[model samples]
Target chain A: MSERLNVSKTYKLYIGGAFPRSESGRSYTVNDAKGGFLANASRASRKDVRDAVVAARKAQPGWAARTPYNRGQILYRVAEMLQGRCGQFTDELRATGLSKSAATTEVEAAIDRWVWYAGWADKLAQVTGTANPVSGPFFNFSTPEPTGVVGIVAPDSPLLGLVSVLAPAIVTGNTTVLVASETAPLPAITLGEVLATSDLPGGVINILTGRRSELAPWLASHMDVNGLDLTGASGDLAVECEKAAAENLKRVLRPVEADQPTDWTAHPGITRMTTFLETKTVWHPVGV
Target chain B: MGDAVSVSTETLTGAAELRRFLHGLPGVDQVGAEERAARLATRSIKTSAKAYAIDLAISMVDLTTLEGADTPGKVRALCAKAAHPDPADASVPKVAAICVYSDLVAEAVRALEGTGVGVASVATAFPSGRAPLEAKLADTRRAVADGASEIDMVIDRGAFLSGDFQKVFEEIAAIKAECGEVHLKVILETGELVTYDNVRRASWLAMLAGADFIKTSTGKVSPAATLPVTLVMLEAVRDFRARTGRQVGVKPAGGIRTTKDAIKYLVLVNETAGPDWLSPEWFRLGASSVLNDLLMQRRKLTTGVYAGPDYFTLD
Candidate 1:
């Protein structure tokens, strides 16, 4: 029998739950860690960022309206889908210079991190909400609400870091437009496929794999985007993003430990979910 | 422009004559027309040209509120929006008209008395012209008496489909007679017409019956105002002018909610019907949400950043 030829996969941007090429019709070659050819990724333009923000905005209200328990189940389903594709993620991580064992560990940790964030979906209100004692004859209470669309720049830790930043924003019902790590974006695109089959609504999590520097400023300055996460940004880029984000008063999360790389395996606290949440306080007249 | 209307009553004397005149018109190549429209949509109007198109689109909007739950307060608010599209920016041009139901025309007229914005009422049992000829004429008469500058009448699709072209033509001519000085826009409700040939025939029929403008859809049907359908209508108006020397306007309402979609319609008009039909007098957009989108894009061009819906008033 003759040898069979391999059918290579094409990596495209995930916007509004469909995989479409960059509107600019631009693509760049992505090289593996060993300087060998890996694949071509869609080099998203400012228009793609704009489109992602629009999609995230359109999906925000409906996603936030879902019951917290329902949101939790959907997030948990994402972890299950990710687990089934563990081998592919491990292989992609290996191409990104991680050893076999290290790649396996990262994939497992990414799935586990997703599950942890899913657990927080239904219980976040209990921990963050409070009842206050007022001086007048009234009952006062404060509850957390999703802060609309969020723009995220995923760190280069590939699978684990991307999930660590993404799961928290969406588990709380806030839709996100994420710009994946430029050099290591294969894992993110693969993750988008997993999300597509996981029953998560379209436009809830738009993933664009492209140059972070070219795409970040557009997201920061977009007025419709309510919050921004600059985890992958450093130094001047981080400074630029903060300045542009100030134009719209976007709630921004600056990179933690800017001087050093983030340790993705460490415990990710509830701060990420809380950062993109707004507290709404209500006062009811007693015995009215 | 100097000649009187060439499509006289003699050309449309009876039902058989009207059918021969309409059926004798050229058949539309459905695939060719659709391909041309799709090709024109890819033209990129950027920078200064984009700014010009945005303002022009803003000026050509017929800000409409036709919901069954419409109130006087809602009509007044819509009228106010039509007059001052972007309250914060006076440089933004006012919309061409405010479209409402016939009963609310008086309220719209009172609110927009001196704002240079006209009041247009959808009449003739709008969205479905199933009512009698007397009732339809009464509907037109009431709107005109209420001070409406324009009357948008719906055609009897059932008559047009069943080879009763004279009935539809006579109804339009009668409503136009009632409109007198008011611009009479005839709605074909093309979504229910079912074919490109039907759209072309209906456009010619409306123009022959003294329609000041030929509008697509009532904004109440599925697939309202698509690019290909508008292309066919624009071509009909262009051809009608070539033959009769009378230029009519084209308005594509519904489903045009984005600046991109509106710009595509402008490009279609400019290309398919020449630049003469590019002005507000020659063209109008029958839409509500498209105005806000045009405003957001205008702000983005001047301010160098995107504008959000939170800043714009709710439609």
Candidate 2:
């Protein structure tokens, strides 16, 4: 019998729900934590960032228009799909240098975090919104609205950090263009597969794997992007992004405590979801 | 130009002669024309050439709004856009014209006065040329009197399809007469003509009957203005000029909604009809949404970042 060769998976960028190679046709070798070749992830260029923003901007209104309850159901469905793919995620995480137990634990926590955010999808508006008392004969009420397309810089904890940032953004109905962890992007690509199958709409979460420094500034400066999460960016890159983000007055969520490593395992409160939401206040005239 | 007029006077004598002349023209090889258009489309126009093409495409736009709901205010706004496509960027060139329904030509002319932007009105029961000849003639005359410097008249597709080439030819001639000094653009509504051969025939029929420009579609048809259809029309104009020493313009309206699509048409014009038609004077893009995109790309070229739709005004 002839020997069978191992069929390796190609790690391509996920834009608008389809896996496409970088428009610049550039790829960089990704090695496992032990310094062995793992895969060649697409080295996304600034053009990829532009394309991802376009897709995210296009999908945002429709996703935001989906009823809060429906969005909650869809998020829960993503958690369900992730639960079924736990083994694959664990294996990928283990390849990234985590122990077998650590990988399994991280995958479990990521799924739990997704569910935690999913529950908030329908309830966050109530908790954050307000009914104002005014002097006029008008019913004035304020509700939270998704802040259009958001650009997310995922932290180095590929699966858990990516899920922590992305789940909250979408649960609030905002679509996202995410730059995955540079060193460990294979897990992010795998998550894109889970997203594609999980009933989450296409373009709702476009994943780009590349140099964070190369891709982050374009996202921060893109006029159409309503919000930016600079979780993975640090040092000069973070400062440059923050400055560029001011060009469009984008709502920027700076990295915690100025690049202090975030403990992704900690209990994430509603701040992540609230950070990307804009409060819309509506007033109605009382009957004469 | 003199030779073309004489030829038209000779060939357009009757139905049989017009049919013989139109049918005698070369048949279009659909596969070849499509292949050539697709090949030209792949030409990567980048950097300085792209910047020039974008500006040239902008200048050639006939900023159009033909909805039944078009109001005078909307026509005024369109005229403003046609005059200054991007108020934020003074370097942007104004469009060639503002196209509207015949009734709103006055509004467009009022807003576009002194801007050097012509006001073009669609007339002759536009999109569907089913009206009587007198009504159609009246429509054209009304638009011309309303200060429309250009009249886009639709040919009676029903008459043309029924092999009454002479009737279609005479209708174009009559409308051209009503246009007087105003430039007359004959809309073939090529989508209804059914095939490439028919598109070729209609192109010749319109040009021979005294059309200043041969427009591809009314922007209301399903397959409005496609690359191959535009290609055949460009070839017709090129060959018509070669044979009669008269230059006719070509306008492809509808469904062209991107800087990329607009540039592809420019490339087609440059390659098929030669660079003589490259100017806004010889070729025009009849589109509304495509203008903003061209402006966006122009901004993208000038500034190194990709632009967003929110910055531009809605059409």
Candidate 3:
């Protein structure tokens, strides 16, 4: 007889620190690059997105209240978890059809990028805010704050692109409801497992794996989602999401023109961070 | 067996009459009651029936806001919501009543003055019936004087569970007398009462003492008004009417937050208690946030698409 069968894992959605099946009890097949079957990922429904938003909204206040230094530590812990799971990451990426070297390089950069963002958590406010000279008898200043819950459309590069969008939004204390790469959701769910073990609290980053068309429109029109990132949306779908997002005047980050994704490993700078931060300017009587 | 005296305890007075009647009552099977409630919950009601149930459930709501931090402003806003549940949709019926604490009864009464919706006040130590008889009676009288047309009194779970069934009966009778023309809704606080048997017994105990309606919980306690508990109480009221010609209402307060949950309660009432108990006169849901969900669902039924919370009133 063959050796004991491995306990297979069922890919589930990550919402508010728990791995739950899609409320609709739906799943779609995910195949490796060679079209070999891998596993099924939950085909998240709009109700799942609504639940994620509720959870993100619930966790955001406490997360935003944590000291920026503490948030930095949590993000760094995520990088640490990613590094420990480095072998697994490379393996998952390899099965997605990337060459071994490309897979290894992507895993390394993803970890490095997370570490890079971990440092930005505490520094973002000082880098983005300014003291203003005004004509009134008051001290005036402007500072960027977390803009509450953001809905992210993850780029198709799987591990690197998923990390590229998720790390920045959460580092700033804004909770996120993110859709993982549709075709390449394995690495994304694997990342979700890493996130569960990391010190980062649940709902700070919720990952739902489902169709971009079916899920993105709900996120776009969702009045609760304060911002939308359309990095992963392509062609007419991008245009449709932008149109829907206008209902609430959501702060939208559309893809670079002509259906191109940004270079994932390139210096992402504060663009990702600034995209989700709301600027609050304060003025108080100087002498009072 | 002398005063347990058949099922006609509605007219039965005295401690012996009430206790013998309560003890002689059949014991509730927890598994059976819960299973029946769960089974009824699985009934698939849709389209026109769903729309009707949503609207009917809205009409049966006692829009309640009972809190330590409740203020006149909150009570007034609740009253406004009770009168016009949807400011945008006039087709939506007004709630049956605006429920508040005794202190806010006057505010609720004044805000709902000409709206035709009654004011129901939770009195007699409310969530806990721990106050002395004088204070409890004063609480009831004050709410009634402040213009509360319905007095929701707690049945002293501590007294009821202590086997002092007679004391519990007299307290309700005393409160009922104080209620006068005002409807008296006795809250069993069944969560603390512990068992289905106790809930069934307490239901009969309150009815024997002239409770106009028997409510499940005070909306403060955990396990407040579960579907099974409400089903048991609905059955009690249904049986009570069959034994005596008089009718009493049943209110499953707290934790019923969705239109689906409310409709399930309606189904239980319709099938078990019969269609006679379908109207607001015979049934009610004591809830606060339930109105908003009902309105959202009502809008979903009106418009083909789902309604967002932003489109509704914050009250």
Candidate 4:
């Protein structure tokens, strides 16, 4: 019992702005990057996903209603807090087997990505699109807006990829249910801790850590899910996942080829936003 | 007259006068209240949010390498897939543009043309401006020539820090000249600047150097786009507008995720830049997923039903 207590690590789920152990009370050991047993993460249940959706739905409107500038500013604040934790993120990365410079770069990239998006919250509409020219007495213009609830598969490649997918989705306004990488899930879960402290509205981003292959298909086909990102799946699974996305046409970002080295400069903000955007053309009387 | 004693007293008085003159010099007064007031003025543009019509223009720079993507096609395909087919989504944001590395600018330009989408390229050795001046200029020129409508360039932080403000100013001014009709977004890369005072100084320097927009980061370093840094930059844009009567834009890129994050930026813009700068011309979001959730919520508000993922098609 003493040995168990000494080695046992407790992992909690972030839902509705609070950290709670899974209601199912199921626990699974997650190894560190070094193959050493690091912690026991909650095996989030289907009910937990539902609860998260409810919380996300509840928080959606006000969060969306906020001006983009304010959202940008808050995100900027999160970066400040995260910046203070550079040593922590770096230490975690090192534990994950990354070299010192690699860990530093990973942490820096994550923080930089946040700042990049922080500036975009209030400005995407003008640069990516414009008002439509309708041949009617009504005024019509299109503004790309947020999709309500998103189900994300945090990239299994660890820190950088995990944030790469997660940040783009939520930064633009959609709430997310993230299935973190099974093997390298610590950083993703740590992100949840960061979000919890950063004044983010609850349900905006809900993280679940377990077997990716187990939870992904359920999330992929789940009626509540609005988008899917498959950055970490195996080749065979990625194909099947695409077909699954067709179930509801969930916005699916297929995994990159294994042989290719990641370019680090793809337009993440645009690709992810388009997945959940719906074009709503408003019409109003012009002579009012 | 007591010649010797009076003469000594007179000399002392002259010396005191000389000390006061030296204290009144520009460098000496750099930290004075009047100087601080001027700096504050440069940082903030006072205004009422209601009067300002703030437009939210969001953009996405999908760093696939960070996501672990190796090829440009995969990156471009993803970007093409990311654009909304419908030009207008009442609920979601109409992504203002798609920003990519210059190497992929042509792809983004080709994918987005006639789709009502603009292509923005990160030039001047984006994410890092460690290149030579010639290389930076050539890079900017190439990106613009490749059909990039907006040029996001990073100012030389090293030179700026070394008090070579002239060098920093000259590089941006030169790049701005090369942009022709294209807009120039001068990135301060504020994380590397170290202090709000430096951030403020950099902001002023960029605007003075013909920057159409002053941005905060390269999205390449830690400690990117911070609220305090942004606040200081916003203050600079506001002051510049007042001093020059030429409105300069602010872009606080990097690490922003979620709707709450987007809104905070909006609030900052409204509070600092006033109502006029609220349009897309003045305000924009360099983001990836912000549009999707906006679309979903808008659907819910209008239809009174939660539209699942299938309601919208991916680009």
Question: Chain A TM-scores, all candidates?
Answer: 0.98, 0.98, 0.97, 0.88
Candidate 2: regions farther than 4 A off: B1-9
Q: What share of the true interface contacts does candidate 2 keep?
A: 0.63
RMSD of each: 2.6, 2.2, 2.5, 21.9
TM-scores, all models, native as reference:
0.96, 0.98, 0.94, 0.46
Per-residue lDDT tens digits of candidate 1, residues B1-315? 122234453556878878877887778899999899999999999999999999999999999999999999999999889999999999999999999999999999999989999999999998789999999999999999999999999999999998899889989999999999999999999999999989999999999999999999999999899999999999989988887789999999999999999999999999999999999998999999989899999999988888889999996
- TM-score of model 1 vs. true structure: 0.96
- Give the lDDT of residue B145 in candidate 4: 91
Better TM-score candidate (1, 2): 2
Which prediction has the highest TM-score against the true structure? 2
Q: What is the C-alpha lDDT of each candidate?
A: 0.93, 0.92, 0.89, 0.68
Docking quality (DockQ) for each candidate: 0.79, 0.74, 0.24, 0.11
* lDDT preference between candidates 2 and 3, better one: 2
Report the lDDT tens digits of candidate 3 across residue range A110-179: 9999999999988988999999999989888999999888999998998988999999888998999999
For TM-score, candidate 1 versus 4, the one ahead is 1
Q: Interface RMSD computed for candidate 4 is what?
A: 5.6
Q: Write the per-residue lDDT of candidate 2 for residues B1-315, one digit (tens) a residue.
A: 333334553546877877877776667899999999999999999999999999999999999999999999988888888888999999999999989999998888888889999999999998898899999989988899999999999999998999999889889999998998999999999999999999999999999899999999998998999999999999999988887789999999999999999999999999999999999889999999999999988998888777889999997
lDDT of 4 by residue, B177-249 (tens): 9999999999898888876667777887787678898888877787777666776777778877765678888
DockQ versus reference, model 1: 0.79
Backbone clash numbers for all candidates listed? 0, 0, 1, 109
* Candidate 1 residue lDDT tens string, A134-237: 89999999999999999998898899999999999999889999999999999999999999999899999999988899999889889899999999888888
